[model samples]
Target: MKSPLVVLTGLVICCISIPILTSVVSYSNIKQETQTKKNTSSQSSKLEKNEIIKKVINYETVNKETPIINVYNHKLGKVQSMNMEKYLYGVLAGEMSAKFDIEALKAQAVAARTYVSYKQGHKNPSQHKNAVVCTDFKHCQEYKSYEELEKVNGSKWIKNSYSKIKQAVDATKGQIITYNNEPILPLYFSTSSGKTENSEEVFSIKYPYLKSVDSPYDKISPKYTSALKISNKQFVEYLNKSYGDIKLTENNLKNQVKITQLSKGGAVETMKVGNKEIKGTDVRRIFNLNSANFEIDFENSGIDFIVKGYGHGVGMSQWGAEGMAQEGYKYYEILSHYYSQTEIKDTY
Candidate 1:
């Protein structure tokens, strides 16, 4: 009874309905897959961030434990494994006067510890291949064992000084001077010439933290001003020793050997020794002057060098630290004053 047109319309409806149902199923599957991918990507990102945070925490805690170090004892000619704190005690004794204020000793301890830490982190120095540091003051920091201290300073000194030194070391257990969250090269000397020398002025490399700063307290140092008298023949010979052809004379020495330039820190930068130019540092080593900040006074018989300060005139001044401590400054304050733009952090 049905017509042929009605039958064709029914077939068309059936085909269209089948395709619509299949499309709906496909859309549902695609939506589920996309959601799953989004969830996975979010988890992966969180994991990546967590891993980065973990790495930073690990680096910060790397030196959380005390480290035993190998020291090349110049006298024994052998490597000695010693506790880090004990080593610091020896360094404090040798590098600084035990009679210094407690705060000054603490500052020296931190400086010494930071210096050794910096050295150990870098490649082993060529001078001491098997050791992290050496006892030779010329190469590394000076060190003296308890026995050596007893021999040099007497038993009474060892008894009184040892406890004081230990208190300083223990009070500041693992503290070190750092710049940019890294250990710094804590170069200290006996005294300064009114102000510390900028790193570039004294050495080839310039450090941001090692800038010239006034050290008014350095005058309190015993070695603040010293005069060395050298005969004319001796002075001329000393100049010629390094330069080979310096034409300096005993008479009119000031005219011939003139200080051509002075550093910002007030040290001689360059001096004209007759026709030859020489560095102030070379002059210091040649004449064994206390520091490069010296004036040459020509006399009838000899030359007088009126020198100010001692050592290299760079970084922390030992006597200056004591002076600051005497002025009621804390160890950290003393350190901050000398090492500009630096922080004290616990390395262990």
Candidate 2:
């Protein structure tokens, strides 16, 4: 038989050993779980880092080069190929004044570039004949080479101005305005009569981004207001020349002419002269008025045309851009303001 003291000592030892064994197993389980969590977190971090690296590689892999464009020199009647960026320098010189703010010039550059891209995509083979665009202001955007610019502005102006124009072009290189992943028409004009017109109202084609918008800063344009007085006989003769034979007399001008419709932008849409209905655009063309927007007042011996603004008044206003730039708006911001629901995208 065993001693009672010995038995009691054994029982005490068992009690202490049981707790130690339980603690060891519990600690082992906790360590394993902690290791598993650490491994998962490390794997997630590595995957995130790998994704970042892949994106960096993809961005670095793309190579961009300046595009070459074929321009038809309408005066010379020759197609000339040159760098697109160089073309923009000439376009900026011809379209917008060099004295404009850098931001405004940049905005014009992007618009001109987008215009070229859009035209290139929808090439009127008959109009340009293998040329991407023409130098004619009536047909395509205006473009003036360094030689032409020097002749027009003098060598002194070129020395002081060309650098700024080049800077504007280079700063926004390979950028174009896009709506719905396509280049927009990018129409622009000298000024507006406080607002822009919808594309449908002016061009008979509707575009969502080309909706009417307010442009109150165009008053700064020198062509904002103009007046021309034409004698009753001259007015009647001009109308007759354009619109076949119409029953109209010099003295009865006030009673015979009637404005039939006005555009939402407040420009004349149609007018009736005697028995003939003439489009406001046709009238402006026949009379050489500054724009389609005009008001006719009958005078004792003549008719006076009071004109406001210039150009088609259907898109970005040049003077309005200058005003926005002067107000500290960035080029992109100016574009976004003028072209609704559009995005600036890099062209590669």
Candidate 3:
């Protein structure tokens, strides 16, 4: 019925149409795949940028003006008020300045801030008699007043006797206490008689009427002594002789140490002596005095004296700070002396 030429033309048209349709479908699929890959790449790039931004911003910037809560206990009921700066200073108290990493410090600051903020204005009227028993370290018994401390120990005056504790508390305003930021109670004593076994035993035998019992870890203690022991007169003389040209005054004697100006080392707290900078830990090797000797039995004169703690024997002994605060020293003076230049600014 159909012509041979018509059939041939129809077959040609079919063949042409099939190839064009196939090409269109294939091109469309390829374009779709390309778009998908581009989208995925763009998303990945965005994610990388976000991560970089996060890394760049510090905690202070990210969580600006967040409320700080100082929790008195783990119970979450008793709390005090503080800001991030105050809390961080409290947490980083006594630690060398260089040891602080900003991010890590911020995290700690947040936790302390929360704890203190939660405890604000909590008046439970609980007996101050709840003593902190030191399981890891020995603590002294709590005394109501200086008279009570004297009655128990035979030493009447704790004012000048424990002057370092008072000075540190006065200097820092009680915000920066705690060795390593662990909460500890403060114990007051007339002397350091009950601090060590040897000291306690000797005091007990020497003074039979005195009570040589361990006291709570108060900010005040008998362990307070100078880093380099020269008599007050000798110390002044050393300052006058070493730095006679520079204006010397009793008020500036403590602040006159040029070595304190240097920033804390990355891993080591150091001081500059002459041309050589020395680690605070190593200063004992260069100087020696009978009074400067600590933690060493001088019975053997040849042996090197081993020191117990670091820093000058003034203010909140870092270990003593936590102890005193746990026993309860309001957080103001803690920040004062430890950091000479800084003030406790409210961030919240």
Candidate 4:
């Protein structure tokens, strides 16, 4: 009925209105769905986080009273009696937290127990003997009695040795450590090979027997050399084998060996053996080749050797500890001297 222009305008208005209404409804629905999803996701995530925290918080409390039993070797009998605390103390004592696992702790407990029992009465199980009450090796120099040794060495030597033995017995709980389950006795070596002119030649009495050698430092045998020589390429191979797979290059050689990460309360380090990247704990086990008590042949060296020191190089060097103790260092001070980034806590 209206003019052609008016009819066209009315049609255009209707078309635009329909589309605008549809778009507004679709957007409202989409916004509601998105908000619902976000709320659900946030709640789920919060629940997961709370569960993880709860588990962590309950771990110590749950395991605190767990009964720890003594693990024994059938050959040696009951090695040692311990609960968690005592076992933990033993691992810490050896600076072995990096390699510490339940199995390792059990092994250490056995060793500690066996050592303690052997020290207590294994020397002469049938007979009870009084503890060795002397000051130093010098005092035990074929002297008839403590009085005689004291007279010869003087009051200082007597006091030092007595104090040393007391401290040693107390620290080890009167346990006699066996190199390979045999009693570790004082081993003596002549600083100068083939009987010396000096009556009191420099003697090393503790573990990892350090002997004075006449050979030039460079000419020193590879066994005695501490520097591990490996080319850049070889180091890469070593790392792959020892640590599975890792990012390594000639550039990493600058750091050499270093603790890269810690896992399950253990230290993980990047170490190069030959020319490879190996990741694991560093345990230094030292062996002595110069003890006269145990004979060795340079040509065909085959001896049932008994050695000491649990992990790499030399540890708290017992002789070194004794020296520090003599100089009035306490037990804690002696422990701190050898280990870094460690705190002393009561085992009990």
Best by lDDT: 2
Off by over 4 Å in 2: 1-63
For candidate 3, lDDT tens digit of each residue in 68-176? 4332322223344444343334333312121222322322233233323323323333522221110111221111223333465355334433333333322322232
Q: Candidate 2 lDDT, tens digit per residue, 284-325?
A: 888898888899999889999988889888879999999998
TM-score of each: 0.80, 0.80, 0.22, 0.26
Q: Which stretches of candidate 4 lie over 4 Å from their true place?
A: 57-227, 230-348
**Candidate 1, clashing residue pairs?**
none
RMSD over all Cα atoms, model 3:
20.8
The lDDT values for all models are: 0.88, 0.89, 0.34, 0.35
What lDDT score is found at residue 247 in candidate 3?
A: 51
Q: Write the per-residue lDDT of candidate 4 for residues 1-348, one digit (tens) a residue.
A: 899999999999999999999999999999999999999999999998897565331101121242353433222333344443343243223322212222222223323333333344334423322322111223211112344546765788657543443233234332222344443332221121111111112221333212221211111122221222345565456545545645655544455444343222122223343345434322121122332111111112221322111122222333333334445444444333333222332121
Question: Candidate 2: lDDT over CA atoms?
Answer: 0.89
Q: Quote the RMSD, in angstroms, for model 2.
A: 13.3
Q: Cα lDDT for residue 161, model 3? A: 33
Candidate 1: C-alpha RMSD to true structure equals 17.2
TM-score, structure 1 vs. true: 0.80
When summed lDDT is taken over every stretch of 10 residues in candidate 1, the lowest stretch is 54-63
lDDT of 1 by residue, 1-348 (tens): 899999999999999999999999999999999999999999999998897665331112335567799999989989999999999889888888889999999999999999888887885657787788999888889998988898988988978998899888877878889999888899999988899899898897899999899999999899999999989888888878877777777777778888999888899989888998889999999999999999888888888999999988789999999999998778888999999999888878
Model 4: worst 10 consecutive residues (lDDT sum)? 190-199
Give the total clashing residue pairs for model 2. Answer: 0
